[model samples]
Target chain A: MSDSTQVAATPAAPAEVPVAVRRAAAKPVSFGQVVGRSPFVPYLFLLPGLALFVVFFAWPAVEAVEASFTDYSIVNPLHVVGFANYTELFHDEVFLAALGHSLIVMVGLLPFSVAIPLWLAILVNRKLRGIQVFRAVYFLPVITSMITVAVAWNYVFADKGVLNWLVATLGLSDAPIHFLLDPHWALASVILVEGWKGIGTYMMIYLAGLQAIPGDLYEAAEIDGAGAWQRFTRVTLPLMRPFMAVALAIEMVNALQVFTSVYVLTQGGPNDHTTTAGYFVWSQAFQHYRFGYASAAGVVVWAILIALALVNHRLTNGKQANTP
Target chain B: MSERQVLRRRRGARWTVRRIGVYLLLAAIAVVFVWPFLFLLATAFKAPTQDVYSFPPSLIPRPPVLTWLHNAWTQIPFPRYLLNSLLYVLGGVPLFVLISAMTAYPLATASFRGSKVMFFAILSTMFVPAELMLIPRFLVANQLGLTNTYAGVILPGVLSAFGVFLLRQAFAAVPAELGEAARLDGCGEWRVFWTVMLPVVRPTLAISAIFGFIFIWNDFLWPLVVLNDDTKYPIALGIAYLTGISGTDTRTLSAGTLLSLVPIVVFFLLLQRQILEGAKGAVKG
Candidate 1:
């Protein structure tokens, strides 16, 4: 989310302590000083972590890019195809459908990620009793495994389950609608589950933003005869821009990488109607052993993520500068 | 005085109504979030005669039974799967936390030659989607002969930027003075890190551990990719397997799913105070 960077940069203690003590202590002379002051010590500290990173992230990332250019079936040695996989992907129906599906999910999640969660944050941000308990209750979904959540919702989306019952009772539909089995409803249903599970996360992020806002700003606005809506529009929303930016960026990444829910719930089923880019990669690589093709799709997914991230970065950057 | 008192009384009445409205809204939202789990709980206990799905969908299991729970356990090696999960968490979380702390220590305290580069390098890893890395990572593990093994599942997860980033924040939050004091006492960087720095960030370590536990416990895709043997399947995958076997029987599936969830949920509830605070602090960034 880049939230780590933002949070890490916040200096914990006030800068009352002078730099002299730190500098002096950093260069303390002793037998240990021989080891401590060496330029190699930091590398020593970083060695194990960096080694794991090399083996897992760095090397594999390079290999993934490399494999994307090659026809590397699991049963055969790699053969360089020179963008054949990518070109094939352009015409691949499932790949195109997966791309479209991922976009739909990404777009569909905005309300839950941005708007509803903001409202949720505001509601739970009140000074009512047992508020934390309610916050925890809402966050239960986020903590639980996606498999468990998917299973829980499987019944909820059953033809005669609670959702259909609610729809029928409200006169929203004429009959009980099959949510997961119907191709039109499957992707939307999965997206809803993804959104529902993630609302707690976004809510907490917005809550932090809401709480950071000084109450005196609201009190001052009230004194000036601004009602709740005016205070929210004038004071709260503007101040929460940075938090929303972070949330949006995170949501885009999360929504793009949605796999567990799709795997557990729909398996990109009902004629590939629910195959996301992430799920497509898995299907290609694991299910079919099309390593090169999967790597190519993976590269596409990576490119899309980078593009979205850059766009979000620019948007948030401009807004944040204007605010602070 | 009477006029002012009457106005004050009316304001109090309005506030009460508003408070009641707020509570109702909160309750409604809570129900939306909690109902699925409650339904899961009910279905897991429902007797065979009770309809798991009906026109109105009854949640109360008339004469709940444990037959399904017994079936779920016996049908699959549920205990074995649980043990595999526990093994992954135990083997993975500690190493994950330690590596993260080590990586964070230098970034927080030292202005090394390549510290900035190192920090960005680690942060950049977050951008590499796990979905993309799945194929290549599995290949690397294959080349290393780690496939179909515990190390394959656990090692790759230890290298996450989330842990390093969170610990970096915690380590940086510690005042430089504590580090200085230890250094002045002739402590080496290692001693300073182990005795001086890490202890101060113990709560952050605990937070990292909790996160690591939840992640390794619930992890599905990577483990699914790396491990081929059914015997090595963790509980998350186990639940998926159980569903595959009992496709139509809601009772058995619910019991298995519920069983899979209980451990982590209980663990979370027990340590919820700390976990929630950690969550808030994480997003406060």
Candidate 2:
């Protein structure tokens, strides 16, 4: 089955075609000839998907924007509040703290999403036996649900858990740290779990990038009497910039929208220290029934994410030009 | 021995030592990655008399029991959640793949008017983060009276840019000659798409299905928002609900969480090769 599919999927083998036929085939076929000459055929095929996209995405997106400008809620009738929701968001201490916490999470996640994963990818990008096993093991967390991960981590963050035991054994602190309960440590603990769960995905991305790098470049570097560290610094790091950009882009989006872990682990707890932008949106809308306020907050996050994505694109493309 | 031979022997010994060190380092990291699941496993089966939390975490549940597993099964609607998750994957993945293929086929093969515009419009959905969509999507669903329905949970998620993008690449890779040959046989475009094109791109379809299965199975937030009924919860949400009610019953919670993980982990393990390769292909594309 696969062989037949491969044959069909591949372009017409050059050897099988006569010179005349090949020459004739060189002329591009018109789209009309391919599907009965009716322009509506393609539209028919696209109808279901497009319909869903409009109903689910386009409609909702417009509603989100429109709802943001008004004081909308399930209980109260909709009223146009102009920029009140946005203005209130700026002044609201909780929302500002939530945004600040999201920023910290994004920065804290850099090592997990970029540096640590790159190192792990390099370590595992070897020809040794059973290396695939290591890759699969690392990727385990990526496949599991965040809820399950949070539940598993609860045991680790418990008062008499493995983490506390390790810290005490290492003489880091006298008393056990209340990782989820303490306001000071709650956000950091949430970040740790989020980062830990994400390391696998970023590691795989780096591994893909690493595998794409030509081996002969390293061989050439070795021939030039460059040591391993120098080879990595000079050849590997530069080639890896594109992959790093991809990782950072994904990490930023993920960090900004970190609700599941916060929900499962801390619930913005111990005085809302762990509340993030994503959590704030959920809490305002669902928990407190402030749909308009939440929509406004969501729009701000959406704007920031788009801006970050644009800046990342500019930086990566700009650096690519400068390097070569 | 000659001096050169002695030098070679010394170098071989150093290489062996380095190999051992690398292996040891890898094993340690592997443990760090796998330890949590192992702990969950141990805790789920832990005897009632054994302390779940200890200073030096004892992982080996001495004379492990099935009491917590029983509790996890009977205390909540575990079977109902499992069945709902199964139904979701069954209802969602096929439709997801089919819609992606249908959408991608025209975009990939035909050069119709507004094709590029349509493609970008679909691709632009990738930027609209799910978190940001929650409130208004809920409002839309509420307006449509889809809230608390199975369709509400499954419909919004079936269409994704990633699936369309991946399937577009797959459809584009197929030789045009095959379609031409089928057309010569008086096959309509629909027949060509269903029989000729789809079978040829079966592997890509499989890849899409695997990803869809994992996604729909583990979808938490959308279902949580859409469905207020506990009986309709998927396994992931079910586990969260379990955690909420079980509170400090760590053993039962661990058991429930472990059970929730079984289907996904097993699916992943079985298709790890395809999934890992597909992950790379996804990024490169």
- Model 1 chain A: weakest 10-residue lDDT segment is A1-10
Off by over 4 Å in 1: A1-36, A75-77, A322-324, B1-14
Quick one: best DockQ, which candidate? 1
lDDT of 1 by residue, A103-149 (tens): 99999999999999999999999899888888988888988889899
Model 2, position B191: C-alpha lDDT score: 64
Clashing pairs in 1: none
lDDT of 2: 0.86
TM-score of chain A of each: 0.87, 0.88
Per-residue lDDT of B155 in model 2? 97
- Best candidate, lDDT-wise? 2
In model 2, the runs with Cα more than 4 Å from the true position are A1-36, A318-324, B1-14, B108-112, B172-192, B195-197
Clashing pairs in 2: none
TM-score of model 2 (CA atoms): 0.90
